[model samples]
Target: MSDFLSKFNGENYQEWVDEKDQKKEPKNPPQKETATTEKEVVETPKKEQAEPKNEAAKATKKDVAKKTADASQTTKSKQEQKPAVPDTAPKKNASVHPTNRAQVKQEQKTATPVTATKRASTEETEIDPTYQKKKKRKRILIGAGTALLCIILYVIYYNSVHVAMPDFTDKPVTDVTKWATKNKIELDLKQEFSTETDENVVISQEVAKNKKVKKGKTVSFTVSKGADPEEILKLPDFSKMDKGSVEKWIDENKANGMKVVLEFNDEIAKNKVIKFEIKDPNIVAAEYKRKDYATVYVSKGKEVFEKDISVPDFNGKTKAEVETWAKTNDIKMTYEEADSNEVEVDKIISQSIAANEKVAKHDEMSVTVSLGKAIVVPNFANFTPDEAASVPNLTVRVRKQFHGSVPFGGLIAQTIEPGARLTGKDETEVIVTYSEGAPFLKDYKGQVVGDLPRLFYEDYHSKGADINYTLAYVDSYETKGTVVSMSNFNEYVGMSYLVTISISKGNLDQPAGYSPKGKESLGDLEEE
Candidate 1:
């Protein structure tokens, strides 16, 4: 009964239930000893009082191990020696009921877990086979999943670091944008103008081709707006435009990158333009990347022409009158002379230009004037009658006359005198000599009067005159027969005049008596 009560100690309730339910199998038990039963039962309380709970747990395991060993030894020894039985059974106390023995046996069967109740609470439960297989499958699946995740991560990292950048040199901007976005890359887009590329085309990129880049890396790029969207210059027709207007346009547009050059043309007027020279002929709506040279060809005008002017007429006007008018009007005028019977002298004959003719400054003007008809008489002195009679375009006549030192029939003087201008109808005459003596009667002065005209009728005879000549002989202190006095000396006079003279007849022996001779009248000698 004591052992039975001891088995019902406080901690064995769960173990007792487990044993009744047969939830677990029992291990081999220890062999019993009559000698140790009372001592062991008493010593268990003392052992518990001395040791800690963990130490008691250790002691319990050791006790279990010793019981197992002792049971094994007892079994082995019983097999070897056929153990002897006790002489007789020891008697029990009379207080123990017979029914109690049966109950005790029953209790002993229920009490199989009393020893198990002392086992540690931390002990592992035995595994189920089916549950173990299921658990193994779950572990394998988890390990595989982890390994696959690692591989995926590695692949992503590799792509980010080792992937090559795409060529964007001529790619469209929108395509580049999409590529960048899908790759999760950062993009910096910039715009610029280009003449060699299409609009919105990529001109340049920051990242080089075939180079590795990380995901989300930044990229810078430039795009083209297709050949500079500059305004094409609509130039004026410079051929008709003046220089001043073209210069003004240049001044205004030079700030917009217009560069102007100048040239000259002869066909255009001065300060006017001929044409403009530009590199692009058909270009419109174009923009300039820099200043370009464009030429504006201007005109220098005709080199031969000076200025325009109006010419004046000079017909029927005198040269003097035209000269004065030309000086006033700043005209360049010159004069020429021409003879014409119909035109009056000093009158304008013709002019280079008609009236109201247009002309320019420094232009030449020529005028012609008329000179009247004129005639000059020919000289007839010192010529023979036949030579003087042969004067061109003149009738010639001669009068018999005496002239000094002139031979007979030689011309002495002329009527309608030499160098005297006349009309074509004027008559002409010449005084021709037919006698070889002095033209006038001889002077009888300071002569001895001895020499007399033996041939006075042949030479040096007195001509016709009005003067009465008295050939008187007188006595004087002069040579004999010398002329003493005369009404006129031997001088030239008109044939119509008369003359008187006196002769001295002094004797040569002494200056005494002079003789007188009878004087005769000399009539007009020309008639003679």
Candidate 2:
């Protein structure tokens, strides 16, 4: 039973031990907790370190998000703002986008600081747009200012360096510009020796000083250093002075610089001075002081004379007697065969010097008595046209008349009579007549229109025949040297013929026959 009681006690003791163990275990647990707390405390520093790092990472993330948000906000604000349009809008749309333009502008604005920072960081930086633009503008202004200053400096230098010159006229050289321009004259300067003006100065002027000259007119002046030699005096003009006055003037002016020389001139009247001369001739300088004398020439008046003297009849006088009478009365006589067949030969035909005129003592007298014979007339009829016209001092007249038998326009007879005594210097007249033959038609060819009829008559007249002729023109022809068609009355009736003849003796190579058109041909003719 003791055993049984021990077992119960053991159980009860174990139960009691269990209950105490629980209680004791709670206390150990507290000690273990304390140990755990100590272990945790030991690990707390590492955890603290990790927590601070995590908190720092979170804070950095928050700050980065704020910065991104701020940047996005700034971008959105900028996007919302419209760029101001320039007043002068582009005609065409610009190629750059507004955003790109704003970005470029923003980049420019931020470029300086960025560059500075970049320079600080990297030690090298690119130039900024603003700085570049300001530098470019400054350079441009400086260049422009430099150029302007250069121009101003050039002007100042030019003005300061100029020098004033003297007036041209007051200088040594004479100024001919004014004189030449004013007078419209051409100036020609010539060098000469003169005392009147300084060296190279104008000594004398042509056309006188201050005289108005026409354009292209010549003006001459002498420029010289010294004077010239004296000139000889010139002879005086005495064209209308009397002979005595001229001689007296020459004698009285002997001391002056002139000498008289004498020569006879038939053109000048007798006892008259024809011309004079200076004793010594030379070119004189300006302002020469000398008494100038002149030789004089005078004229003697015309010779005296009388006309109309009484004729001394030489009818009964011999040749010697007539010669004596002619010598005493200053008469000239010539004899020829008388025109009257009944008159005797050796008689005077005519006298040239008239009777009873006052005559000079040196007068020549001539007397001619007739030779007792009839002289044959010279055949002047066959003379050529020129020879016929050159009959000197002989007057001739031609006329047309009518004859019943001779050709109509033939020479009839002479008035003074051919082969008759030609008395004195009187002209002989010729009378021509026309024949009474029936009219023959003439070929009026090459006759001047105005002179056809007269020329036609003359053609036949020169043939020593006369005829009635009617002219007809075959064609309009030109007039040449003479008329070239006439009728022949002797034969070939009703037949037309051509003839050429000169109409008048005056027109036959006579000196005054035809008017000349030029001086070359008119030299032989008389002047009007």
- The model with the greatest lDDT is 1
C-alpha lDDT values of all predictions = 0.56, 0.42
- Model 2 poorest ten-residue lDDT run: 35-44
Clashes of 1: 24
Cα-based lDDT at residue 243, candidate 1: 75
- 131-186 per-residue lDDT for model 2 (tens digits): 33454587799999999999999877754543222233212444665645654556
Please give the TM-score that candidate 1 achieves against the real structure: 0.21
On residues 174-248, what C-alpha lDDT tens digit does candidate 1 reach at each position? 989898878888888888766566778999989899888787788899998664334354566667678788888
